[model samples]
Target: TGYGDDHTREIMRQELRERLIQAEREGRPLRVYCGYDPRTTDLHLGHTITMHKLRQFQEFGHHVIFLIGSFTSLIGDPDDVKAREILTPEKVAENAQTYKEQAFKILDPKKTEVRHNSEWLAELGFLDVIKLAQHFTVQQFLAREGFSNRLEDGNPIYLHEFFYPLMQGYDPIGLKADAQVGGQDQLFNLMAGRQLMQKLGVQPQVVIAMGESLPGTDGIEKMSKSKGNHIALLSEPGQMYTSLMKLPDFAMPLYFKLLLGWSQEDVDDMMVRINRGEVEPQEVKAGMALDITTIFHGREAALQGREFSRKAMQEGGIPDDIAEHVILSDTPLVDLLVVTGLCKSKGDAKRQIQGGGVRRDSDKVTDFDEIVRVTDLPTVLQY
Candidate 1:
C-alpha cells in the first residue's frame, strides 16, 4: 500500500522490509498498527487501504493493532482541512461500536487486536499533554497539507488542532509499535509517532503511507462520505457493484490496482486488450465489480450483484439483488426512501422525486405525496 514519489516510496518499502527482517531475527513479532478516527459509523472502501496492509502483517505473524481514535475523533483528524464538528462522547461511543465488525471485512478479526485511544488519552493530565507537545513545533504542524490549506485560505485553525499530531504520535509510544500503516495524507502523523517513540528511547516504527487516495465515483477528488461519493463496506452487494461501475473508464486501471491489488503489467495488459477490442470494457468492469463484492459479500452475493448490474444497468430491468423492504402498511414514498437509507431525509427524498431523479420501475416519481402499497414491496427506487 506504499505510495509517494519513487524515492520516498522506495525508502518506505526498504524500511518496512528491514523492520520485518528484524522482527524475525529478534524472534518477536513486530508491533504494527493503523489508527482510525471513529468519526463515522460506516467504514468505506477508501478506508481499507491500510486495513489490507495490516492483514498482510497478520499473515507474516506480526502483532497487528486496530486502534480506534475515540478521543481523536472529537478533536478531529488534522489531515482533513475543514473545521470539525466535535462529536459528543455518546456519538463517538456509538460509532466505535460498529468499527470492529466492519473492519473484519478486510482484517482477520481473530488475529487483530482492537483498542480505543480514550483508554489512555482520557487519562492524560495537562502536564502530560505538555510533555507530549514538546516534541513538535507550530511551524511543522502548519506545514502539513491540510493545515497549510487552512492557513492559505484564511480559515481559523484552532490551537487544539495542532495537538492532534502530537496525540497521534503518542499512540505508538503507548503501544510500543514498531510500524504504522496509514493513508498518504497520514505520513506526517505517522512520522510524528516515529519521532515520539524514538524520544522515549524506543525504536522508531517503520511508516508505510499507503498509495495515493482512490478517487470518488466522480473520478476526481478522493472518495468522501460527506460528498456522497464513497462506497461503504457496509453497503449491500448491489450498492457496491453499482458504485464501482460508476467510475470513468480512465480510472478502471487504478481501481484494478488499488482495490484488486493487480500489478502494473497486468493492469496495462488488460487495458491493451480492451483498447484492441479483444474484450468489452463493460464486461471487464462487471468482473471488477464481482471481484470486489466477493471479498465482502461472498461469491453467491457477488454473482447476484453481477446479474443485478446486467439487468438494472445494462437491460433497464429491476435488479433482483435490491433489498426487499417489506411494506407492512402504506406510507409516503418519501418516508420509505428515508427509512431505507436510500435518501438522507424525507425532504431530500421529496426533492429528488420532484427533480425527476427518483424513479419507480419505468415511471418517474413526480409526486412527493405519493402513497406506497403492499404491491410496491418489491419496489425499486432508482436515483
Candidate 2:
C-alpha cells in the first residue's frame, strides 16, 4: 500500500469516485487489473493483499483482469537492490501452472479474466520498444530508489532492468485498464503505467496502491518467501494456524486488519481491550488463527488445526489424529526423526536433540545417539 501522502490519497479517492459514476453512466463495468509474477511456485499471504482488493472490485460488478507476468518474470522486478537472476521461459511457465488455482482461494474464478502479459509484450518489436523508451529519460529511471541505492553502493544495474517498468507500463495500454492495484513498493511501477497511458494518448488508469505491508512471522520484515517468513497459500491448515499463532502480539492488529479486513477503529478497540486486560492476547490470536485458516482450509479443518495447536502447545500432548509411523524394530532417533518428517535431515535432528528440543513421551531427549525402540512405538514425540 504505497499512496505516499494523505493529499495524494484523497485525490485518488475523488478520481475513483468520479470514474465509477462515469462507468455507471456508460452502462459498463470499470476494467481493473493487478498483475502477479510467478517467481515462486506458490503464492504467500503477502501476495493476497492486492488480490483481496481485486475481489472487492469483482464484488462491485467491475471487470477484473488477473494478469500473469509471464514476460516480466524473465527479468524479475527491479525493486531489489541487486539485479535478480533471470528465469527461463520453461521455469516461469512451470511456476505459472498453479498460480491460478492458488489465486482462486481468494478470488472469484468466474468473475476474473486471466491473461498472460506475454500476449502483448512478446509481440512488441524493437521499434515499438524504442518508441516506448522515448517517453522516459535515463535520469527518471535513475531517480527510482532501487536503482539509486544500487548506484550509490556501486552495484551494477543491468540495462535490461530499466525495461521492466516499460513493459509493465505497456500492460495498462494493452488492457485499457481503468484502475490498477498493487503494493506500496510497486508505486513507481504503477505510476509508470499511468504516465505511459497519458503519453500514448490513452486515458491514464487510476492507481490504487495499497498502503500497508504485511510483516512476516518475525513481525519485523515484510513477508517474503526468500526471507523464509512467508505463510504459503498452499500450506497445510495446521501449519498455517501455527505460523500465524507464532506472530508477535504487536503484529496481530495489522494481521487482523489486512487479512480479516477489520476496520482501523475495530483494530484500535481490540488493542485497547487487550491493553486494558479485557481479553487475553492468546485468545484473540487463537481466534484470528482460526478465522484465517478457515478462509483457505474450511471451518472443520481450521477447528482441527486449532485443536492440534492446543494439544501440542498448551496441553503438552499430541493430537489423537497425529500421523502414526509404525516401526518394526529399533531405529536411531535421528533417523526416525527424518523418516517421520519431524526434522529436515539427520543434522537437523541432531541439532534439535543438542538444543534439548526433541522429546519423547514428554521427556527431553538429550542424546543425539538415542535409539527409538519398538517399546517406544506408542510414545509421542514432540519438537
Candidate 3:
C-alpha cells in the first residue's frame, strides 16, 4: 500500500499506523474509500494503485466504498496541466458504467460499496456550495502546484477550479470515511476532506497516498489515456504483453517495484546483471511481460502470449506494435491478412502462408485458405 517515493511512502505508512491505532481505540472498523473520476471508460495500470490499497482495506475487514466521482469528473481535475473538456452528465454516466466492473477485477464486490458522488454533489444548491466554499480561501487553492503553475504562467485558472477539492473533501464527510486512498497529487484534496470533517465536528479521514503517477508506455509522463500512453485494463493478453515489453529498459526498476512489487535487492541484481551483460534486457522484459499478463489473463493465456511474442521475435517479420483489427469467425485467413493490411494483397497473404512465414499465435499458418474464428483474434502475422 505504501507505493511512492521514500518521503510519500513514509508519510502514508505513518498515517496508516496512526489510523489503525485510532480505529482500535474507537472499537470500530475504518470506512475506507478511494474516489475515481470516470473521465474515461477503461482504467490503465496506474489507476489501480489506490484501488489495490482499497482492496487491502477490504481484505482484513473494513467498510470499503468505491466512490465514483461522477460530479467531480465534470470539474476535470485542476491537478492536470491542461483543462479537460467538461463532459455531460450522460457522458459521465457512460464513462462510469464500466468502472465498477473493472474495479471488481481488483476489489472484492461482496465487500465493496459503490457510490456515485453525483448522489450528493449534484444535489448541492448554490447556497450549499457557497457554504462549502467558505471553508477554504482562494489562497489555499493557489498553493496547489497545478493551480499555482497555471496562475503564474498567465494561463486561465477558472474560478470553478477551486471547487474541485471542496467537492472531493465533502465526499469523506458525507460517507464519514475514516481513511481514503488516492494518488500522491490527491493528498492535498484529501487534506481538504480532513479540514472540513474537523470543522463539521467529525474525525478527519486518514489519507493513504499511493502512486506518484505511474510512468506511461512512453516512459516519460504519467500513464494517461489522453496521451495514448496507457495500457488499458481490458487489453487482450497479447496486447498487454506487447505494451509491457515495449517499456524502456530504464523504466523497468520502477515498473517492477510499483507494478510487480520487486524488492530493491532484486531490482539491483537485475540492473547489475543487465549492466554486466549477464542477461539480455529483452529477456528480462519478456519475464516481466509474462508475469503481468498472468496477473490479468491467467497463466495459460500468459504462456500463450509469451509463445506468440517469442515466435514473432524468432520470425523477425511481425512488427511488435501493429494496430489490432477485429476479424469475425469463419473468415478466410488470406482475407483476414489482407483486411488487416498485413499483406499487400491476397496473393501476398497466400505466398506468406505457403512459405510458412505466417503464424497464428504459436502455430505456423499452413493454409492461407484456412478459416479463422473469433477465438483466433490477436493473431500474429509474419511476412
How do the predictions measure up, each by TM-score?
Answer: 0.82, 0.83, 0.82
RMSD of each: 5.7, 6.9, 5.0
Put down candidate 3 lDDT per residue, 1-383, tens digits, no spaces: 22235775676668778888888898988899999898888788888777777877888888899999999999767754667678898999999887888788788999999999998999999999988888899888887888788888888887777888899999997787888888887778877898888878887777777645679998888888878999887777777887889899988887887777788899999999999999999999989989878877789988877766565656655665656554435788789888878799998888888888887755788975688776765576544
Off by over 4 Å in 2: 1-3, 312-383
| TM-score for candidate 2, residues paired by index | 0.83
Q: Mark the 10 consecutive residues where model 2 has the least summed lDDT.
A: 315-324
Stretches of candidate 1 off by over 4 Å are: 1-11, 79-81, 314-338, 341-383
In terms of lDDT, the best-performing candidate is 2
Candidate 2 clashing pairs, residues 3+ apart or interchain:
1-184, 1-210, 1-211, 2-184, 2-210
Query: Which should have the higher lDDT, number 2 or number 3?
Result: 2
lDDT of 2 by residue, 12-38 (tens): 898899999999999999999999998
- What clash count goes with each model? 0, 5, 0
In candidate 3, stretches whose alpha carbon ends up further than 4 angstroms from where it belongs are 1-15, 25-27, 79-81, 311-319, 325-374, 380-383
User: Candidate 3: what lDDT?
Assistant: 0.81
